[model samples]
Target: MAYTSLYRRYRPDTFRDVIGQEHIVRTLVNQIKSGNIGHAYLFTGTRGTGKTSVAKIFSRAVNCLHPVDGSPCGKCEVCLELALSGNFDILEIDAASNNSVDQIRELTDKINFPPTIGRYKVYIVDEVHMLSKSAHNALLKTLEEPPEHAIFILATTEVHAIPATILSRCLRFDFRLVPTSAIAARIRFIFDEIGVEYEEQAVNMIAAAGQGSVRDALSIADMCVSFCAGNVTYDGVMEVLGTSDPVKLVGFVGNILSGNVDEALKTVAEMCDSGKSMAILASDVAALLRNAIYVKTCETAAEILSLPEEQCAALRALGEKHSVQKMLSVLKTMTATEGEFRYSTQHRILFESAVISAATEAPAAGTTAKERELEQKIAQLERKVQALAKPGFKSAPAKEDAVQVWARVASELQKKGAAFIALAATEAEVESDGGVFRVKVGSSSCMKILTDKSNRDLLNEAFSSVCGQKLVIEEVKKLDEDKSLPYITSMFGKYLEIK
Candidate 1:
C-alpha cells in the first residue's frame, strides 16, 4: 500500500470521530437521523477545522444503505463507492480552479438531472468564495431551488467574501478550531495506536504549534513520526517544525520584565543562531504574553490559563506582579514588530528593539494603579491653577495675571538650568504671599519638572529675591476643558459682576 499522510489515515469515519465541533456534529447527525437534511448546506470556518471532513461524512451518511444512527456503516456499497471510487452522484468540485461562470453554468445545467445511482446528488464545492460574481449569480438560482435529488455543500474559510444572496440560500454551519488539549490527546492516541513512542511534553508542544487545526496537527505529527524514526522526542519535533524554544521565550520575557536589555538581546541572538525565524518567535511570544495578561486579570487558573495546573499557577503569580496594562503594552510591542521581523535583515536587532519598547514604556492611562494616581494628582493641581486665572478666579488681584505668572516660572526654570522644562511650561499662574511667589505650572510635563527638588528650590529663591521675601513653590495640572481667559485690563468689568 502507498504511504498515506496522518490526517488522511486518521480521517474521522463517523461524527463521533470528529473532534472539537460536537455541537455541529450533533445537529448534522440529528438531521440525518430525522431525514430532514437540507438541499443547500454551507460549512464555514478556518482551514483544518473539519469542514471538508464533515461534508464527506454527511454525504456518506445520507447515501448509505445501512447507516447506523446517522453514521455510515462503511460496509454498504454506496459508502464504499463514495469513500473509494469517484461516485458520479457525489461530485467534489474545487471551486478555486473552476471559479468562472461557464463552469458554474455547467454545474447548474447538471443539477436539474436526478442522481444516477444514489438517493441524492451532492455537489461539494470547496472554497466556494473563490467563485466570481457572475458564477455566484449562476449558482444562486440553482441553489435557491435545488432539485429534490440535489444537495449543495459550500465550504469557505472566508465567509464574508461570499455574497449575502448566496449565503441566504444555504444552511450555514460554522466550525471552530479544535482545542489544544483535545488535539494533543488525539495525537497521543494516534501515535500509540501506530506503535510509535512519544513523550507527553512533545505531544503538548505539537498541539500548541497546531494552533487548533486537527489536520495541521496531524500533518505535523506525521513529520515528527518520520523525523524521529517512529520514536518522537521534543527536540526532534521542535527541530522539524522550526519552532522557537519555549525556554528561550520564557527567558526572553523574564529579561524584559527585569529590564535587562543585554540579556534579552543575547537570548534573541541565540534563537537567530539556531536558525529559527524571528517572526515566528515574535508571534509565539505575543501569544504567550496575551495568555499571561489573561491570567493576570482573571486570577482564576481554571478559567484562564490553558497550561498544566503547575504552569498555570506560575503564570498567575507573574500576572499578579505585572499589571494587565503592562502585559498589554508588551503584547502590542511584540505584535507591532512581527511584521518588522519578517522584513528585517538584522532580525536580532529588531527583536531587541521591540522588547525594549514593550518593557520600559509606560502603561496606557487609567490602566495601571500607579499611572492613575499620578494622573489624578496632576489633574487636581491643574484645576486649582485654572480657577485662579478665571474672572472670579480669586476676586482679588494680588499682582500677577497669566502672563506675569508664566514669565516668573520661565525665569525661575531658566535659573535652575531646567531650560527645556521651563520652555515647555509656556503657560502658568503666579501667586504672591509677601515676597514669596508660587508658580502653578500648566502642563503635566512642566509640573513633573517643577516637582524636581532642584527646580523647585531654584524657582523659590529666584522669585523670593525679586519680591524681597521667601517664595513658596506650588504646581497645578493642565485641564482638558479650556476656560475663557479674563484679561486683567477688563478685570473691573468682570470683578463687579463677580461681587
Candidate 2:
C-alpha cells in the first residue's frame, strides 16, 4: 500500500466521526434521516474543519442501502461498491483546477443522468468559489434545478467569492475551526491507537500551533511522529513549528516589561541560535502580550483566551503587577514592528527596537510601583487635558478658555532659550489651577523638550508675563489627534538618528 497522509487516513467516514461542527452535522444528518435531502448543498468554512469530510459522508449516507441513524452503514452493497470503485457515481471535481466554462458545461450535461448503483448521484465540487463568472452562470441553472438523482455539494473556504445567486440555491453549512482541547483529544486518540508515547503538553502545543485547524494539527502531529520517532515532547514540537517555547515568550515579555534589555536580547539570541525564526518568535511574544492585556483587564480572561490552565494562571499572576495601559503600550509596539519583521531581513534589529519601544514606554524598573501610581495619576490628568483641547471645552470660572490659555502659553514659549521648545509645541495648550499651570504639549516629543524644569519655569514666567499672574508649572502631555501619521514618521526618523 502507498503512504497516506494522516489527514486522509483519519478522514471522517461517518457523521459521528466529524468534530467541532455539531450544528452542521446535526442538520445534515437529520435531513438525510428524514429524507428531506436538498439537491444543492453549500459547505463553507476554513480548511480542515470537516466541510469536505462531511460532504463525503453525506454523499455516502444519502446513497447507502441502509443508513443507521443518518450515517452510512459500510457493509451495504451500494456502500461497498462505491467505496471499492472510486468515482463510480460520486464525481469529485476540483473546481480550482477545472473552473472553466467548458468544464462546467460538461458537468451540467451529465447531471441529468441517473446514478449507476446508488440511489443518488453526488457531485462534490471542492473550492467552488474559484469558478469564473461564465462558469458560475453555466452551473447556476443546473445547481438551482438539478435532476432528482443528482446532488451537488459545493465546498469553498472563501464563500463570499461565490455569487449571491449560487449561494441562494443551496443549503449553506458553515464549519468552525475545531477547538484546541478537541483537537488534542483527537491527537491523543490517534497516538493511543498507533501505540505511540507522547506527553500531554506536546499534544497541546501541536493543537495550539494549528490555530484551530484539525487537518493542520494532524499534519503537524504526523510530522512530529516522524521527527520524534515515537516519543513526542513539547520542545520537539516547538522546534518543528519554528517557534520558541511559550515559556520563553513569557520570559521575554517579563524581561521587556521589567526593562531588562540585556536579558531580553539574550533570549532573542538564544532563539536565533537555536535556529528559530524571529518572525514566529515575535508572533508568539505578541500573542502572550495580548493575553496579558486580556488577563489584566478582563474579569473573564480564561473564558476569552484559549490558553492552558497553568499558562493562563501564570499570565494573570504576572499581569496583576501591570496596568492595562502599559500592556496596550507594549501591544502597540509589537503591532508596529509586525509588518516590518515580515519584509525586513534585519529581524534581530527590528526585534530589539520593538522591545526598546515597549520597555521605554513602561515605568522604570527600580521604582515600578511608585512610578506606576504616578503614571496613572498623569494618565488621568492627561485625559482632562485632552478634553480641554477639544472644541467647545468648558472649565471652572478660574480656568481661562483653553484656546486663549494656549495662545498665551505658546507666545511665552517662543522666547530666546525656549525657541526650540516653542517650535515643537506650536499647538500647545494650557489649563490654570489657581496658581499652577498645566501645559499639554503637541506630542510626547514636545513634552521631552519643554518638560525640563528650566524650560517650563521660563514658560511659567512668560505665562505670568502674558496673563499677568504668578503661576507654577505643573504637568505636560501630548495632544490627542486622530490623524497623526506625519508625527509618527518624524518621530521614527528622529529615533533612527539618535540610536
Q: How high is each candidate's TM-score?
A: 0.65, 0.68
Q: Could you say which candidate leads in TM-score?
A: 2
Candidate 1: which stretches are off by over 4 Å?
A: 99-110, 260-284, 298-314, 328-499
RMSD of each: 23.1, 19.2
Q: Candidate 2: where is the Cα deviation over 4 Å? A: 99-109, 272-280, 295-305, 337-350, 353-357, 360-499
By lDDT, who's the top model here? 2
Q: Write the per-residue lDDT of candidate 1 for residues 1-499, one digit (tens) a residue.
A: 8999989989999988899999899999899889998989989987888999999889888888888889889898777777765556777776655324333334444555676666988888888765555456556766766668878899987575577898888899999867779888999989989999998888987875676678878988999999999889989988987756665566677677656778877887777787777767787787667566555544342332335444455566666566555666787687667645545688777877787777677544444678656545533433333332221122122332323354555555565777765554443456655335566554444566666787666655655554444454454432112111121112112112221
TM-score of 1: 0.65
lDDT of each: 0.67, 0.69
Q: How do the residues 1-499 of candidate 2 rate in per-residue lDDT, one tens digit apiece?
A: 8878888888988888888899998998899889999999999887888888898899999999899879999989988988974445787776655324344344443555678889898888888765555456656766655778888899987665677899999889988767778888899999998888999999988876665678988999999999999999887897787666777678788888877888988987887897777766666676677677666555555543456666787798768776656766786677557546646889988888888778877473543678667656644443333333332222221233334455545545653556675554443455654444555543344565666778766766766665543553332321122212222222112212110
Against the true structure, candidate 2 reaches a TM-score of 0.68
